[model samples]
Structures are given as C-alpha cells and as structure tokens.
Target: MARIQIDLPEHFGFSTAIPVYLSHINYSGHVDNALLLTLVTEARVRYFQSLGYTEMDVEGVGIILADAAVQYKSEAFHGEIMDISMTATDFNKYGCDLLWRMRDQVSGREVARGKSGIVFFDYGTHRIAPVPPAFRQLFE
Candidate 1:
C-alpha cells in the first residue's frame, strides 16, 4: 500500500456524530466497514462545505473522485462518539486530495485514516481538466 501522511490544517473542521441503533455490532461484534464509510462520507461533505468547496462545483470547477484509499486501525462500537477531523491538504494538476482522520472522542485513539483523489471535470466539454489555480492556491 502507498501510504500518505497528512498534515492537518488548523481550520480543518469536524462533524458531530453519535452512533445509531442500526449501526450496531456486526456478527463479529464491531462496527462494519460499510457503516464506517457512510460516517466518513457525511463528515467529508461538511469539510468541503467549510472550505467553500464540494464534490461538485468547487468554485465553478466541477470535480469528482478519481480514486480513494482507506485504512482501519481500530473498531468503533455502537453508542460511541466518533469525532471525524478532516481537511483538504493537497492538490495537483490532475486532482486534489482530501485527508481524513477519525478518532474516539474520549480515548484519543485513531479509528481510521483515509485519502481521496479528486479530479476536475470540465462540465461544458465533459472532459477531465486540471485543478483550478484557485484550488491549488489554498494549499502548500
């Protein structure tokens, strides 16, 4: 696996969440991976919104996921408060990358880490395009 270490931004924000009844123990008695993705997705959308960006229409330049990677370091159980801290740390010609680190609110242990590759699209031409200069200007 190609691992990327993300340096989180100070302004990066988190979304509040509480485990649901449906998000109960799996047969193995742990939060399922599918639920984890759902939870992460919710927080990610909020992150983009905080940055004045989104999965679409990122400052008039549309972008979609080109690739994604996720790693599960630990498990979360029902009734847990999972604080998902997220940020947009990097971008390139082909796409931008969003990094996420989720942890237990009480224990301060990492529950998961993830990175997503976001590629720009020319909504008019219907073709992939380079990330906008403005988006690039937001990062290191």
Candidate 2:
C-alpha cells in the first residue's frame, strides 16, 4: 500500500504556535498520531478567527471537514512548541482544501504535513452551500 503524500506549499497564509502537552504523548513518548488532528483542528479554528470568522459562521455559512490526510515526518515530544502553518487551495464551487504543516519550533524539524477538504455547509438546512465570496476574497 502506498502511504499518503502531502506536498505542502512554500508559503502559508497563516501560522500559530501550540504547545504539546503530556496528554498528547503516546506510549512511545512522542505526540500521538490522533492528537495531531486535534492540533490542526485548533489551528484551523484560530485561522478562521483571525479571518474574522468562526467554524459556525464563515461568510454566512458554516464549514464541514469533508476529509483529511496527514504525512508524518518526525516525532514531536511533550513540552515542545509546534509551529503550524495553514493556507487554502484547490478551490471549487462549494469547497477548498486547507493545507497544513507542523514543525518543531525550536529545532525547525517538520513533524507532519496534511490537508483537510472543507465544504461550506448550511447547518440550518443541512446541505452543502456555495463558497462565500467574502471568504474567497481573503485569499485573493
């Protein structure tokens, strides 16, 4: 079987720092694979907040993560600060891809690279919505 390969962008539109806690460590003493998803989730929320939006209120529609893929590079240990960078790409009528890269802040070693496919959703109607123009403008 082929492993998932994520080619991260050279530049990211947003970045934030998050500290790895003991809870994030697995039995092997490094950050767990599952926990990296949570880290990216946090970063994604923060990225939206910085764009003057929230998970439930971006450009008059919420967002639903359609899918995700991650490629692990190095182990991240507890007490280490992870630098996460994010950007949007692969736009369609109703969705786009949010690319992310996580690295050890101090050593500058890449920890993981991933992308989440996000689609605009109308929670009230329980259906997919078109990508908001204002939201697209942020990257334009």
Candidate 3:
C-alpha cells in the first residue's frame, strides 16, 4: 500500500512544544495515531495565535479544515515532549496547506509529518472566502 508523504518546508514559521500525557497513549503504550492529529491541531492553533489570529477569526475570516494527512515515522511514548514545527504552503485563491513535522524534543527522533488543507470561510455568508491578505502576508 502507498503511504502518505508530507514534504515539509526548509524553514518553519512556527513551532510549539507538546508533552505527551498518559491519556495520549494507546494500548500499545505509545502515542496513538489519532492523537498525533490532535497534537498537530494544537500546534496549528498556536501557529495562528503567533500571528495574532484565532481559528474563527484569521484576519476577519475563519478557517475550515478541508483535509488532512499524517505520515508516522516513529513511536512516541508518554511523558516525552514533542517539538512540532509548521509552515504555510501551496496557497491558492481561498486556501493553503499547513505542513508540519514532529519530533521528540529530547531524542531528536522524528515522530510524524503531516499537512492540513485549510480554507477561509465566511461564517455569516456561509461560503468560502478569499484568503485574507494579512494571513497570507505572514507566510510570504
């Protein structure tokens, strides 16, 4: 079977640290695959916050995740801090891709690589909107 491949940028515009708690572990004693998305979601929020925007208000328009993909590289155990880095790429009229990489902060071992396709949406209008200039500027 073919696997997902995420090509990360050479430099990340944002990074955040997340510690794996016991709750994040699976029956196999490592972080569950599903929880990796959760961690990336948290990193995405911090990425926006670093740019002074929220998920619901990124330069006046909210973001709706259009799609997501994750490629696991290594196992992460509970009680370890993961360093997640992200950047915006593959921009379009109304959306862009947020690519991410995660590694163990202590061991420098890669845990996962992923990307989320996000579209700007106007909640009141209930329609897709153009990418806000301010939001795009940060990625430039």
Per-residue lDDT tens digits of candidate 3, residues 28-105? Answer: 999999987888999999999998889999878899999998889999999999999999999999999999999999
- After superposition, which runs of candidate 2 have C-alpha atoms over 4 Å from their true positions? none
Could you estimate the TM-score for every candidate? 0.78, 0.97, 0.97
**Stretches of model 1 off by over 4 angstroms after superposition:** 1-21
Q: Tell me the whole-model lDDT of each prediction, alpha carbons only.
A: 0.74, 0.95, 0.92
lDDT order, best first, reads 2, 3, 1
Model 3 bad stretches (over 4 Å): none
Lowest summed lDDT across 10 adjacent residues in model 1 is found at: 12-21
Best by TM-score: 2
lDDT of 1: 0.74
| Clashes in predicted model 1 | 0
CA lDDT, candidate 1, residue 83:
85
| lDDT (Cα, 0-100) at 62 in candidate 2 | 99
In order, how many clashes per candidate?
A: 0, 0, 0
